[model samples]
Target: MSLSYAYLLTQMVIFIPAIESWLRADPHEVLIVTTIEWYERIKASLETVDDPRVIVHAIEVKSKRPGLIAGIQRTTTDHVVLLDDDSIWSLATLQGLLCGLSAGPRVAGVSNIKVNIRMTLPALAPDAPSMFEAMGAGRHDRRAATNTAMAYFCDSQITCYTSETTAYRTEALQRPGFVEHVVEDYWKGKCKLSSGDDGAITRLYQNGRKTGIVVHDECAIEPKSKENTDYLKQILQWSRSEVRQLVRDPYLLLPSHRRH
Candidate 1:
């Protein structure tokens, strides 16, 4: 029952809180993998943690996928928990993930539902309506409906596992070509993909003989939201990934072999 927590860190401010929360979950070890530049800048802050279980690994490679793969390779635990730098999790969430994996040997991975914080603007005056309210009279209703529809679709059809807050049996992760399979874009004939590692990993495990689970608990992870230009860029990147997945692996769209 050894557990290793691995985080691919980009922003130190957000990652610090995420790491602190994960530490409270009491994993056997914590691996923080980041770029060498970031590691040098945040070395002092990391040194203050003073935990023998925490190990910082800096790589010359500057991509998230490589850093994550490197960190996973260094894990010495039977179970590995993959986390994004901006994701915040609770101890209960950690336990729930482990419990889900413990349900059966064929369970390759388990991930919790994710909740994104809605971005809103402050009210201009005491009598002013809130930003969401100002969107229109029925905007809230439409938003609620959309949320429900997406949630239903995710739970019922898709492989609801994302790297933001996922736990995997190390055996599944150690499968031959797992890392390269996730990071490479075969459809577009690319050496490396800029994003969509989560989707790739989910599809990989789902296509295997084993199954994956999405824990229905309060183990919701909150990832930092992008704003303005960054938000648009993020949306574009996700859209590209989705298109690529659909084109390359249409079976993911089928409603089969998913565990809730």
Candidate 2:
């Protein structure tokens, strides 16, 4: 019953709470994966962790999809958590995600509400309903259909639900040659043309069933850099193309992209 988990970080600073929460929430073994440059940061971030089940490794991926594929190959755990430095989750949220993993194989992945870290302020704080607006959850934090891309506001209630910090079953991700395909797309510029990690995961989920939000509240994420605005837009367009190609395959195809 060991849950194998991988967390990915780029140029962003790591928040200690996220790691602390992962250590506490990990039902089994946990591994922290990051770029070679962040090795020291990963060690410093784990100072408070008392769990022996946690291990940290350095990966050389310079971009999102490749990093994720490397992390997945490194993990032998039954479950995996792909996360970013900016994505934060609580212990309770992680617990809920683990509980849902027992539901069976068709469930490829799960998302939480991811809010814009920079957008948090008293004056502009989001109410419960508005927080999940982009993700298509009703006021009650209801579950929408899985396997589709949905947007939720980056608020205190639920963050973006982007795979930057998502939980998945290893078999589901390993199937359909998930990591291999992502890497191929990366080399092909599909990953770069799309936004980044989110687009890569969206493409992955299109090949499988991405469950609705199960974690309590949501995870917080920062907005992309102003300098990378064009990059994000290109990522969006590339994501559309990748989804179309991936979904057309007979073995791994999802029903269709349902707009939430």
Candidate 3:
């Protein structure tokens, strides 16, 4: 049987101009999960979409993890799309991501081939480093190294880390073990962590018994401000997350393609 699915947007409220066009292409249900503070406002935005299937859920947790955790918890569809707020998907992009998930029942999720908006141009303007975004982030979005890594994992039958926009089988996430981390993660079985949710989910699918397919060309991301200290802080947070992830699951260092 075909899988039933709904899009679950995280981190930001849905107001992107491009989203209207995207909905025109595939009017699938979209559920935006947010913190309690934005709940009423986000709930009101539901009227913005023509599709009645669209809905919003609110979690008391102030962290972004609540968006993902509460989002998956509220949906009963066979599949859930964990799409970020800053992502831009073309009319065909949503289908493209789903195509990867349709590979087989064993497939847990599908990762999008994400690119940065600066990539819309032939090349990044020479001085992008000083612009609103960091050069490495935009330049690496479609760099050869990233593509090669994806190819190696896909061809080698290894799971790729889904990011930016990914569609996951509901069962894959409903598993008790995976859900626990999403609810609240702990560092070294001691300190509690309410963040690094994106990293945690990626490591789960990448190292889990289930598998995933990588869509080589579809998703694009909005650039961040270089002037914003928030962006710099985010980078620092990611750095710490990497350390915790490696220790939590050493398999991340050399994940095996073979699954039991």
Candidate 4:
């Protein structure tokens, strides 16, 4: 299938293994979009990639949500797969995502199950390098529950978004209405927010009565250690965003309005 892979780079330094993953996937294009401030740094790192299919662009906008909009607007393929630069994926995972997205026309996007793999460093032997170690596989590698965002039992309708490698139909994204919403969205039409990426993207697929499917073999392997306070903080941030949706749908909290 002809589709583009959109990678969002937020850091100044490039993740080498992530670049390798996209190259190995060998999709129609590996479009890496980074923040404008880190454009030069990321561009310099792009030199290592000699493939003609790789395209690196900078998001001029100052915010995260708009940055994603820039990538969607640049995509030329009928389908585009969104990826996190910090996460690495197997070729099989990409195949499954594409298959799930293309299964039906009304299916706007497919959310892949993100498995967080705890990262650990092996200590080298002091005596000598491991004698038994002959060869090693490089260019590789979630311990999280709630792998995908499934509907909950609230008024028989409780849907949320997935923050993983998701495949979305390009046609749905090109609409004028959705693009405008991504550009600038305010909470309660009063407070301006700089973030709310997952919720906005979820609407991208779920908009127009379209359905977002949670089907996959497995998505990206995010090698991160939750052994520190930083992990807890990140989880808290996500919880806050997820809860923001519940704020709008107050009936989710009411047993009278909710279904069994």
Query: Against the hidden reference, what TM-scores do the models get?
Result: 0.77, 0.60, 0.75, 0.73
| Candidate 4 residue lDDT tens string, 1-260 | 23333334333233666667767776888776676677777677778777777777776666666666777878888888766665566767667777776667776776555442213334453533132111111111111222222333331122444544667788877877886776667788987665557666665454344444443435444432233455455555666776776686545345553333
Greater-TM-score candidate between 2 and 4: 4
Task: List where candidate 1 sits over 4 angstroms from the true fold.
Answer: 1-10, 116-157, 215-217, 226-228, 255-260
TM-score order of candidates, top first: 1, 3, 4, 2
lDDT, candidate 3, equals 0.57
Q: Give the TM-score comparing model 3 with the true structure, all chains together.
A: 0.75
Q: Note the Cα lDDT for every prediction shown.
A: 0.64, 0.51, 0.57, 0.56
Give the per-residue Cα lDDT of candidate 3 at 166: 64
Better of 1 and 4 by TM-score: 1
| Global lDDT of model 4 | 0.56
Q: Write the per-residue lDDT of candidate 2 for residues 1-260, one digit (tens) a residue.
A: 23333444333334455555566654567666666887787677566666677677777755655656656777677778777553455546666666555565656666655443323445355532233232222211222222222323211112123554567777766776665556555434443332345545555564335454553444322222222345345445545654654454333322233322
Model 2 lowest lDDT segment of ten: 151-160
Candidate achieving higher lDDT, 1 or 4: 1
In the order shown, the candidates' Cα RMSDs to the true structure are 5.4, 7.9, 4.5, 7.3
TM-score of candidate 1 to 2 decimals: 0.77
Which 10-residue window in model 4 sums to the lowest lDDT?
134-143
Model 3 segments beyond 4 Å from truth?
Answer: 1-14, 25-27, 44-50, 122-130, 135-163, 206-208, 213-215, 218-227, 255-260
**Model 1 lDDT per residue over 95-198, tens place:** 77887778778778776665423323335656454332343323323323433443366443233356567788887888899877866646557446857777
